[model samples]
Target: MEYRNLGHSGLMISEVTYGNWLTHGELVDREQAVACVRAALDAGVTTFDTADVYAQGAAEELLGAALEGVRRSSLVIASKVCLPTGDGPNDRGLSRKHIMESCEASLRRLRTDYLDLYQAHRFDGTTPLEETLIAFDDLVRQGKVLYLGVSEWTAPQIASALTVIRELGLRSRIVSNQPQYNMLWRVIEPEVVPLCLREGIGQLAFQPLAQGVLTGKYLPGREAPDGSRGKAGGRAPTFIGRVLGRPLLERVQDLIPLAGECGMSAAQLAIAWVLRQPGVSSVVAGATRPEQVTENAAASGRTLDDAVLKRVDEVLGDLVDRDHGKTAQMMAVKPSWTSTTP
Candidate 1:
C-alpha cells in the first residue's frame, strides 16, 4: 500500500486506513473483528481510526485486543471524542474535563499508552476554542497524544483553532482533519480541501464508498438488500444509507454504468476517485469481513484514467447544475454525498 505524510508531521500513514465504525461493534463479533484487523495489517494498512462513541467504546476495545501482538511503532492509531457517551448533558462536547477524561478512557480501551492522533469529533459551539486548544496542548505535553485534530469542522473553526494553537505555543500540531469525502460528496473540496492544502493539514476521508451506495449494492428500482444499513432507519442510519433521498439515490445509481465501463467495481472506482483529490492523505474505510479489507486495499494504488476522471466530473457537475437555483455552495459538500458517492 502507498504511504503518505500526514500533513507536515513526521508521521506517515497508509493511503488506505482501517476504520471501526458500524461494522466493528455492531455488525461483526469479536472474532470477526480480529480477523478484519489482521487482514488489514497483512495488506499493509498501518493506520486504524475509531471514535469513542462507536458502539459505546466497544470498537476501541475490540481493536485493542486485535492488535495485541503487532509492533506499536509500525502502525498509526487514531480516535475521536465530542460524541455523547452517556445520557447526561455533560456527557459530550470538547470541554477540558471531557477531553481529559475521554483521552484516558480511549487509551485504556485501545490498550495503548499514547494515541497517534486524537481528534474532536465535531466543533463544540459550547466551548471556547482557546479552552479546547489549551486542553489538547496539555495532552501533548503530558505525552498522552502525539497530534490533535478536529472532524467536520468548518474552515473558520479550523482557522480559529490554528490561531489559538499559535498563541498558546502548543506542542501538538493539528496535523489532520477527518471529514467525510467520497465520489458522491465533494462538499469538502470547495473550502475544506483548499484550507487543508494551504495550511498543510492532511485530509483523512471516511465513507469513501458512500456507505456501500457506490458499491452498486443498492439499485435504482430494487429494494435495499437485507442486512444493509438502510434497513435500520433513524437519523444515523439515514445519514449512512441516504436511501431516503430520491435525488441522491438516482445520481448514485447513474454512476454504476461508469464504474462498469472502467472495468472496476463501484466501490473501487469510488475510493480511487477520492484518492485522486489533492490534500487527501488517507481514506479510512471499514470492514466487517476479512475479504472486504483486501478488496478495499486493492483500490489503494489504482488511479482513474484522465478520461474516467473527466467523466466523473461531468456527471457530478450535471447534478450540481440540475439542482440549480438553490445555490449549491453550502450544499456543495452535502453530508448525503458521503453516503451515496464517496
Candidate 2:
C-alpha cells in the first residue's frame, strides 16, 4: 500500500484507511468485522478510522479487539469526538469536559493509551471555539492524542480555530480534516481544499465511492442490487439515499465504460478519483466483508490519467454537489436530544 504524510506532519498513513462507520458492531457481526480488519491488514492497510458515536462506541471496541495482537507502533488509529454519545448535556459537544472525557473513553474503548489522530466529529456551534481548541491542545500535552483533526468543518471554522491556536501558541495543530468527499460530493473542493492546502492540513476523505453509488451497483430503475447500502433493508439509507436518484444513477452508469477503459472496477476508479484531489491524504473506505476491503486497498497506489479525469467530469456533468454552503447547512442541524443552550 502507498503511504503519504498527513499534510505537513511527518506521520505517514496508508492511502486507503479502513473505517467502520455503519458496519462493525451495528450492521456486520463481530466475526465479519474482525475478518474485514484482518483483510485490511493483509492488504497493507495500517490506518484505521472510527468514531466514538459509531454504533454507540461498539465500533471502537470491536476495532480494538480485532487489532489486539498487532504491533501498535505500526498502525495509525484515528477516532473522533463531539457527537452525542449519551443523552446528558455534557455527554456531547467539544467543551473541555466533553473533549477530555471523550478522549479518555475512546482510549479505553480502542485499547490504546493514545490516539494517533483525534478529530472533532463535527463543529460544535454551541461551544466556544477556543474551549474546543484548548481541550485538543491539552490532549496532546497529556500525550492522549498525538495529532488533531476536524470532520465536516467549514473553512471559516477551521480558520478561526487556527487563529486561536496561533494566539495560544498551542503545540498541536490540525493535521487533517475528515470530509465526505467523492466524485458526486465536491463540496470541500471549492473552499475547504484551498484553505487546508494553504494551512498544511490534509484531507482524510470519506465516502469516496459516494457510499457505493460510484460502484455502479445501483443501476437506474433497479432494486439497489439486493445487498447494497442503497437497498431497502441495507445499512445507512439516510446517507446512501442522498445520491440514489434515478437521474444520478443514470449519470453514474456512464462511468462503467470509463472504468473499463481504465482497467479498473467502478469502485476502484471512483476511489482513485478522490485520491487525485489536492490535499487528500487518504480515502476512508468502510466494508462489511473481507473481499470488499481487499478490493478497496487495491485503489491505493493507482493513478488516473488526465483524459480519464476529464471524461469523468464530463460524465458526471452537473450532478455533482459543489456548493461550499452545504457545509454550513450540515452544521446548522443538530440532534433533537442535544440542547441548544449549550
Best by lDDT: 2
For model 1, the superposed segments whose C-alpha errors exceed 4 Å read 232-236, 243-254, 260-263, 320-342
Q: lDDT tens string, model 2, 82-147?
A: 999999999999999999988989999999999999999999989998899988988899898999
lDDT of 1 by residue, 221-309 (tens): 56777766665433336555443345566766678899888777778888889888899999999877798899899888887888998
Which has the greatest TM-score?
A: 2
TM-score of each: 0.89, 0.95
Q: What is the lDDT of residue 33 in candidate 1?
A: 92
Clashing pairs in 1: 182-342, 183-342, 184-341, 184-342, 187-333, 208-342, 209-342
Off by over 4 Å in 2: 232-235, 328-342
Q: What is the C-alpha RMSD of each candidate to the true structure, in Å?
A: 3.8, 4.9
With candidate 1 superimposed using the best TM-score fit, by how many Å does residue 129's alpha carbon deviate from the native?
A: 1.3
